[model samples]
Target chain A: MTIQTLNPAQRTIRTVKPMPLARNRFERMAWIFMRFSGLILVFLSLSHFWLQHLIVGTHQLQFGQTVARWGAAGAPVTIENVFWRLYYVAIIALAMLHGLNGFRQVAYDYLNNRGVYRGVMIAATGVIAVVSLMGLVALLGGATIVK
Target chain B: MLNGLVTTVREGARYKGESNQWMWIAHRISGLGVLLFLVTHISGMSFSYFNPKVHEALIEIYKTPLFSVGELFLAACLVFHAINGTRIALLELKPEWWSEQHKATRASLLITFVLGAPTLVIMAWKSLSFYLATGR
Candidate 1:
């Protein structure tokens, strides 16, 4: 014999409860990424600044100097050592994504209209992508090692 | 008008009792500051591709003692933001660790100081020596 539970009117109540609505998974992931990338950027960017400016002396830092540091032998090959180029590329990519997300958050806070919010997000994405591409190209083009 | 202003100020000052609210606010501010710096930095660095001479000139301007001091402040902001951000990430990703968040915050602060203090001191020493030698 099964015992049934019912609310005052004598109708049996269902045991299973409705599931909660799906959460914004992507937004949650982006939020997590921001925190993780931010921590890493702190170390990467600070060290980059110290090495490039404080240690080498900012006055002495020039395009040619940066090219050499990236391991280019002067022409054609661009990135002689893949590791250094990759290191810089990673920093650029992470920074762009993290900053763009922050920009989106600011927009979400201020913009009430959905259309305007969407527009801001699109613009932010475009800017981040274009700028990151430009940075990569500059790093590669400037460091091209001609053999 | 004066009453309204006072009310507004009082409302703003009221504490909501979230232990991590101050840290969250600082993280947001520093994150925005870093973003602002990135805009200028990327734009200036991009000049290297268009005109090397202009890029070199920009680098020279940035080398000024005044900018060096600014860089130190930027470093402090980034350091605090990053360490606190790490704590937030850990708490959010590992739900089981939520109970220890206050401890995490303290740890993050300690770590930031440990790393940031030396970096600041070294940067200050270098900046001072450079300005003194150049007399700029």
Candidate 2:
């Protein structure tokens, strides 16, 4: 005299999972990348703006001024110089990656053509690579900051 | 194409959303502006390595009134984008708080204005006074 239950005829429809339509790991990584990089950038970027724009006047901003901050052109490298160079490198690298990824996101919104989107991303990547390398060479090249 | 992203989130893009739509639009616009500036900016910095003369010329252009004004605008974009981004990250961390997103958006904007305005004003004053003095 036990109550009995019968099996359902078919699988019940599941509720839609609340997740972005990330087609692959890269897409998921990109989503997470924005958040993490953005978190760091919130401090790095704003302080940088304050430093460059507020702390330093427009007229005072010269090529020599920036290079001098990185390190003396011909003087021995100090720990502070290495620190500034690394700080700049972090900002440049992270900002480029974060900013370019954002640009790509917006581009994808308007660019429905897959081929065109791919081409644009490729070009963007090239610019990021070249610019980042250039920044590295400018900040760390011709001088041994490690010493 | 832009409709879905600017208009909705989490829900299917086809659905109409509320004022938070503006935040999405603002983030994209500000981010794009920053990106464009970054390209030219890093290029000029790097040019300091490969080409010193070119870098000096580029830096000179940056000191012009127009570019200084552009610099102010860039600061605005950066500040807004940073605050707004923090809001987005916070909401993402607590998905349930997505219900209060519009409130968060307003707060973030308000905070941005409070913090960013004084700095921007000071920057503008500095830029103007310097240009006046140097006549450059």
Candidate 3:
């Protein structure tokens, strides 16, 4: 018996395309960010729900009482306050990273031209930087930047 | 079947890159949106510990027009992030299941739209009504 093979002209070789430079570190950073944000959110969101909704009960909460608790400064600064601060900052940072990355994804999916892609990325980075810096200031105990 | 021309036209308009790249970006953005809203929500609720007066003040603010709008935006963020997140997860299920992935994503979005629209409407109505009744 003889093995039969196709002519060279009838054969073809295919190689998977390499990823573009535009999608290197940035994509990895975005993926890592989602996991980190998801983890933080699990704790922050749950604790928040427990503290405000379940423990206190929605109807029981009112203004003066709420203010007094935060105002009463002393030993350990209180676990609740600490949690609140951490929750706020972590959520803010995660949100900035996540949202900006999402926008990049949208641009990648929707935009067609190289020039348009670059332009969109620059604009996105600018917006993310400004918003994230503002969020950081607010979360770090500065005067509230957003109402 | 989806019209071949429609699919072709839509794909034609897509960015000259992998679909995964775009999906990856959107997942990040929506996740961040949820995070941002969560921070604001927790901080605002933190006021509840301050004093009843401040708490009431904050509640009234939430009921007011401006903050009410913000709350609606937050709700929008929640819905979009959740739906999009589910889409990303579905895509990662398995290579063998890849063919059905788009169907699942579309179904998820349909369900989201059905649920989200009514919920948002109710939330807005209730919030607005409470404000009017209180005259705050």
Top model by TM-score, which number?
2
True contacts kept of each: 0.34, 0.64, 0.08
Ranking by TM-score: 2, 1, 3
List, residue by residue over A1-147, the lDDT tens digit for candidate 2: 233444586544455445556556677888898999999999988887788878886567776666667764567777877888888888888888898878888878877678878898999889888888888887886332221
Q: Which 10 consecutive residues of model 1 chain B have the lowest summed lDDT?
A: B1-10
Q: Answer with 2 or 3, whichever has the higher lDDT.
A: 2
Q: How many clashing residue pairs are found in candidate 2?
A: 0
Q: Return the interface RMSD of the candidates, in order shown, one decimal each.
A: 5.5, 4.1, 8.6
True-contact fraction in model 3 equals: 0.08
lDDT of 1 at A1: 30
Q: Write the per-residue lDDT of candidate 2 for residues B29-90, one digit (tens) a residue.
A: 89989888888887777776667777777878888989988988888998999999999998
Model 1 residue B85 distance off true place after TM-score fit, in angstroms:
1.4
**Fnat measured on candidate 2:** 0.64
Residue B11 shift from truth in candidate 2, angstroms: 16
Q: In model 2, what is the error at residue A36, expressed in angstroms?
A: 0.7
Query: What tens-digit string does per-residue lDDT give for candidate 3 at A1-147?
Result: 234455777754454567777777767766766655655554554455445533453334454444334333332456665655566667667656666666666566556677878897898777667665554543344221122
- If the candidates were sorted by their DockQ against the true structure, best first, what order would they fall in? 2, 1, 3
Cα RMSD, each candidate = 8.1, 7.5, 9.3
How far does residue A119 in candidate 1 sit from its true spot (Å)? 5.6
Query: What is the per-residue lDDT of model 3 for residues B25-135, given as tens digits with 9 covering 90 to 100?
Result: 555555556655654554555444333345466665555567667656655556655665656554654567777765766676686677567656766676666667867
- Per-residue lDDT of model 1, residues A1-147, tens digit only: 345778688887556544444546778778778878877886787778668756776555666666665644355444454666777788898998998988777666657678878987898788778778877887665543222
**Candidate 3 Cα misplacement greater than 4 A, ranges:** A1-17, A20-26, A35-76, A111-119, A142-147, B1-63, B66-70, B90-122
